[model samples]
Target chain A: MQQQVDIGEVVLHHAADAYSFGIDPYFLLEWHAWEFMQLGPFNLTPTKHVIFMVIAALLVFLTMRVAGQKLQQQRANENAPKGFANAVEAMVLFVRNDVAIANIGQDGAKFAPFIMTLFFFILYMNLMGLIPFGATATGNLGVTAGLAIMAFVVIEISGVVKLGPVGYMRTIFPSIPGLSGPGAVAMSLFMAPIELLGKMVKPFALCVRLFGNMTAGHFVILSMMGIIFLFGHLTFWNWAIGISVATLILGIMMLEIFVATLQAYVFALLTAVFIGLMQHEH
Target chain B: MLLALLQEAETHGPNSPFEPEFGLIFWTLAVFAVLYWVLQKYAWPAIVGATEERERKIARQLEEAERMNAESQAALDEHKRLLAGAKEDARALIGEAKTVAEKEREGLLAKTRQEQEQILERAKREIEAELGKAIAELRRGAVDLSLAAASRLIDANLDDAANRKLVVEYLDSLEHSR
Candidate 1:
């Protein structure tokens, strides 16, 4: 089905049933009420969701493989590292030492491989959206929220192990040390709901933040690009203006690329932080 | 709250505006597991192996450096030993030369003293011989003078050998006193 909308207004995304408009400044907010990929039986009915996930995974693997091959060739001298390998090495070290280790400490090292993988995986997926007909997997709340829940589960499990049963309860109730009186008890009681909210808020915020940043950047670039199509087939003014606009959009697109990578990094970083906080006293 | 939102999105149902999402949980799990497995197996090993190789190379370089340092130290010690031995040999040669010069100086001094003593002895002998010859000649001359005086004074013929002998003896005594 085809429909015509306003000329100046932006069309953020086009899906099967409905389309989205530009809103939520940070990320393009869109949802499909239906399942695109239907799972086939003995697999007769296949769903678009599964297809999308597989495609996302493959793209991630290929990009990283290209990067990994480049890394090895650079390391042959091993003493002298160069090019993409150097860039990748620098990123790995930063995430490993500066972000992961610094935030998560010794216990966090176990998750380093997975966290690094997640960052690269999300990063590649978000970048693919710039291509024609590609979807942003990270832009979906269901996807981001699901990933957040995994982080949540890991966080809870890690906290439980570190804090023990009584210690985990005490975390939810942080009364001032050496307070045993009724007033102290009351204050602890008052803080419980707020602490609970904060706990729930962590994953919600993570979902929104990743989804928003990735989708918003994509939407803006798409809208800016729509300017070229708006101009007619042949005219000198159209050429000048269209070229200039396209250049501006490309410049903005470069900024979006940086943001795409950074958002992935931040998501992983915050997940580490939340987990670490749970393991620690404060 | 869940039913209401699901219903509202569904109400626009015709070319059904909102289509229900089914078993996202199941496919999501499968894809995620496959992703985790593939990544763990294929991608990570390459990176990890390369990293280990780099580390090994660094370690080898360090070991080589240490070996070179030790070799240099041993060479330096050997060179120092050779230099000390050469210095000792030079000192020994200098001492031997000094002793030989001292012996030569003592021999030259002894030969000069012996030659000087011989020259003085010969001059003394020559002087004594000359003195003896001159004394004898003087005694002979005195005897001759005394005899001539006696003959001129007597003027007669009756003098004998005894008289002549006495005159000679007297002249010898006179020469000795003078």
Candidate 2:
């Protein structure tokens, strides 16, 4: 009996990233956030989320690299595409044709790599959460924020590069004809902050939407687990509740699979759209 | 003061799920950067390039097929035109042969008519010459017979004057009354 209780506690400890191990003192920062030993001055602590993120990244990289090689070879041999190479090529075409090019127009090819990387990275991260004993790195606010920051940087830089500095500034702060020095200055001052806030809001939406969606799915799955524990004490009701809970959890898991891919597509697509908006001045 | 407060917050726990951690964000950015770099270098270019190339090649092939189809259609039309012309030429050739045959038949008819006319004229001339020769011979024979009869009457023993007179009278009567 005591051994089962200990095992349950250990399982819960590993499941929640926000919680510490074994409910010892709940050392908030020290344990809640993953911590590891340092070499010299740099802290290189590999958290569960970070580890999964790396795995997802590696999975995406290796699969795509292999698929890329096969596709190139397929071209050289003039053979019909088949198998994993065929599947990955379809996805690559969809990302390029439907998502990237559809949103970004002619210059879409230039940003195809970045958008494809973002898409596959998020997709793998979302799918990783569904695996046994796997945690979703995208569920982490910090990670999503980081991704959003990267998108934001790309958006801003491409805007400047596509439209020269003056053109980009004019898009943000338009000049009105027949307005003298004072009025022009006043209008520019007024619109500049709003435009800046608008630019920041797009990435903020990307971050919160991805983080909230991923976290919600995980939270529901965890809550379902919690229900099983809540009914554990009542032996009579436990079995009945366990069956229902398991069914409900299975349904949510299926829904999460769809949500995961949808969220990843949304993130990448919106990033492309935002970048495209900046690429052309109205 | 802000740095000191951040240090203090670090010592404690995150205020909420919204709380951002330096290490997590830094690592996320670092990892994503590496992913982007690696993918940008190898995966993206190859995949996009291959897909575009395939699409372009397919379009080119389709265009070539369409052009070939059009050329074949033109060739078929030309063949049909040639066939129709050949049929027309055969019809004209048959008509020309019929006219030529008709002219030859007419010429043969006219030549046969002319030859019949020439043969009739020659037969008439040959019959006329043969009839004239027969009339001349018959006349000569009749005169010889008459002279012989006259000589026989005189030798039958009458006076020469009386016989001569009788014969002369008879000859004159035959001449007058005969």
Please list the C-alpha lDDT of all candidates, in the order they appear.
0.66, 0.79
- The sequence of per-residue lDDT tens digits that candidate 1 reaches over residues A176-233 is 6777899789988888889888888898788788877876676567666666666534
Clashes of each: 21, 0
Per-residue CA lDDT of model 1 for B40-155, tens digit only, reads 67666555555546656998999999999999999999999999999999999999999999999999889889888888888888888878877777666755666666766784
Instruction: Place model 2 in a CAPRI quality band.
Output: incorrect
Model number with the top lDDT = 2
Off by over 4 Å in 2: A1-44, A176-184, B1-17, B54-178
On DockQ, the candidate that comes out on top is 2
TM-score of 1: 0.57
> What DockQ do you compute for every candidate structure?
0.09, 0.18
Interface RMSD of 1: 6.0
